[model samples]
Target: MLSVYGVAPSEQLFKGTSEAEFPAFHGRPVGGPVLVDCKVSIVKLGSHALGDQQSWVWKPVTQGYAVALENQPLSSLKNHLRGLRTLKDESGQNRLWPWFDPRYLKLVLRGLDGDDLVRLFGPVTLFAFALENGVELFSQQDGSLQVKVVSKC
Candidate 1:
């Protein structure tokens, strides 16, 4: 389950749900009071680990700038990550590291393409499924995670 949380450019993108809220991690680097009144887009990369919240943390950027990520199968995401990693920067060095390092993944994610952004994170696992797009997941104040439909206009 790859969960991408962001303030959608417009509220009209979502259907079935009229609004969604992004809990403000104020004082945090990715802090936000993100409130989507109309709708927000949610993309499902694939099935992932059921527990462990740390594995789901990706970049700490705000909506339209970054994505909240969850893990997927390495076999499905490796090629995309490798391709992004091989890209050269202004200094002519590999833009990303060849190895998987959680500490550095956030920085690397900032440089990924939108299409590739779907699965820019996750634990190095083999049991996950292939990537797909559809339902969005969110946690309620009661500590339960729920799913909603997301679409782009």
Candidate 2:
């Protein structure tokens, strides 16, 4: 199965290297307490068999942006989270595999605002997105997070 590795960006190892040199990787070590070390299957991103299971629907908001809405107002994501559990032994960690429905995962992720997206898909996946958008995260004076797009990647 294709996997998503969350490789950390090491300053000591890649300080002067270009973005192209950052390894294209996925997944993380298994059986760890922290979720940043667990691998998630890319196959989970495949379309679902139950077409209506989608919790979010997107509509174009602008030329390059779209907004997602919950398919049902009463059926919030918190209810569906009960079905999203990690392996029997992998409790206390955030990695959910073998049981997670990618569709629902997408919905939950879509529901999260900018500040909540810091750990979305772990560092490597976020790094890939930052690289694509030429953006990086920074802390504000008030302790809030912000996205800063760099002139050069």
Number of the predicted model whose lDDT against the real structure is largest: 1
> What is candidate 2's lDDT per residue for 1-153, written digit by digit as tens?
211111122221212222112222235533333232222221111122111112112111010111111232212222332333443233555554422322333334544455444333222121111223232222222223333444332
Model 2: per-residue Cα lDDT at residue 126: 18
Regions more than 4 Å wrong, model 2: 1-99, 124-153
Candidate 1 ranges with C-alpha deviation above 4 Å:
1-75, 95-99, 111-153
Model 2 scores a C-alpha lDDT of 0.26
Q: Per-residue lDDT tens digits of candidate 1, residues 1-153?
A: 554322223332332231233222212122123231222222222233222222222222112222333454433333443343334567886433322222234344445544343344333222111112322332222222223334322
All candidates' lDDT scores? 0.30, 0.26
- Model 1 / residue 132 / CA error / Å: 28
Question: Where's the lowest-lDDT run of ten residues in candidate 2?
Answer: 58-67
